[model samples]
Target: MASEPPDAAAASRRDGGRPGGLRRMLRRLTASEAEIEAEELQRDVERHGCQPARQVERGQLVSVTGRLRTVVYTPRTTVPTLEADLYDGSDVVTLVWLGRRQIAGIEPGRALTARGRVAIRDDRKVIYNPYYELEAAP
Candidate 1:
């Protein structure tokens, strides 16, 4: 029989009708983790300050050196493609080698420098058939 106050109704709507305290705290914690991860990524990219991957522009010929974070092979497609995600502290770039299943020495945890013109594919930055040099393990 009692009616909710105007402010309580507004707060409930803002919190999606859930109690705000714990839910808000959890949301804040999740956001903090994302912020920390992004900061770490930026710092890693900055270590290679000479050729920062974040500054690479579309269609610009660039030489970026970074550690391979992931290596994926897509053989189901008409053209087999080897895709690798390279991270240089600052940004992540996807490297795609079409018509190839694998390239020797191109694997996760490998350090490599790739030279190519930057392109955007599927809303992600990518380089196709880049000339790459595998770095000596440190």
Candidate 2:
């Protein structure tokens, strides 16, 4: 039998050989459903060129894309706020729109991209009055 060069062997290993298949299967078997979903969402975030919620820093202006997990309208006597939790599979960032009751299509399971400065309120990541664009339903 002929022997392959060291470089060729390395290339095959990097290009998804038997080892890669085994690793991928093991990962799928060991990872939870939520973890796998999160990974997929993270990949989508990268494809959209937006920052992941987990990596967003306080006081930094950033754009994050994710699915809305929840939408709640808090109607206070003074100020009304519409809040939605955007989950990027890595973390959640709360989006708050002030002085409003609700906006059409701002609902759970809807995907969107929001841009604003990150803030920490009650130990949770928040973006107040963010500029957001709704993603088409998938």
Candidate 3:
């Protein structure tokens, strides 16, 4: 079999042998802090063998690991709810605990792994009363 020419080999090495290598590099260079953080979180999710939030189907039991983007307590006439948005880079899954104000260790920027059945409300993914484990602050 014929081998690659000298120029071809050099170019392949320079670009890591992939056409989109340069594009990916450029994207990484220009990515915002949040984007970079999301990418890192995604990698961590994969490393820990947890399901991604974006791929979770409604009604399916899943365990997703991510950082909490926001935590809010909403008070209603009948009950109160604590909600947090868990972002795993690909998507956000809201965790809602009904009749709760807040829980210790559940706050913004904290890492967590939550397991529950997925549900959709008002066109967003939510898990109600999920069993969650808070990760140590990094």
Candidate 4:
């Protein structure tokens, strides 16, 4: 007849009465599939002698290869930009093509390599007008 403690009830509610729910919740909160993949990609890039996005320093010239995670067109700006996020398993760098709406073969889910100088704009890593090459289709 006694009411359950709020903390115990909350924990049970969180994990469906399953054991290690807290651990699972912590892992889910701390890591995502994208993040895990990024970490793995980082290792692979390093193993192959390429700099990962996270290891790229400001003003450093970098050549990074990764899959395009997103491609967005900003038409409302004074100078339109075609922005794409490239994730190489370690981190993501935003590639901005100024005065562009789109480029052939530069779409999301495509593998490509971008080479440019690293810069931080608005606290996000970005590479403007990066020279890009599409990876060979598998």
Name the top TM-score candidate. 2
Clash pairs detected, candidate 2: none
* Model 1 Cα lDDT, one tens digit per residue, 1-138: 998899777667777787665466456667775466555556545564436787888998888877799999998647889999988767888999999999999999888888898999887889999999888986
lDDT tens readout by residue for model 4, 39-116 = 666765766577878789889999988888999999965899999999898678999999999899999988888899
Cα-lDDT of candidate 1 = 0.81
Q: Is candidate 1 or candidate 4 better by lDDT?
A: 4
Clashing pairs in 1: 41-89, 44-89, 45-88, 45-89, 45-90
Record all residue pairs in model 4 with backbone atoms less than 3 Å apart, i.e. clashing: 38-89
TM-score of 4: 0.69
* Ranking of candidates on lDDT, top first: 3, 2, 4, 1
What would the per-residue lDDT of candidate 2 be over residues 13-51, giving only the tens digit for each residue? 765666465566668779999888898889989999999
* Residue 134 displacement (Å), model 2: 1.3
Model 3 lDDT, residue 84, Cα: 99
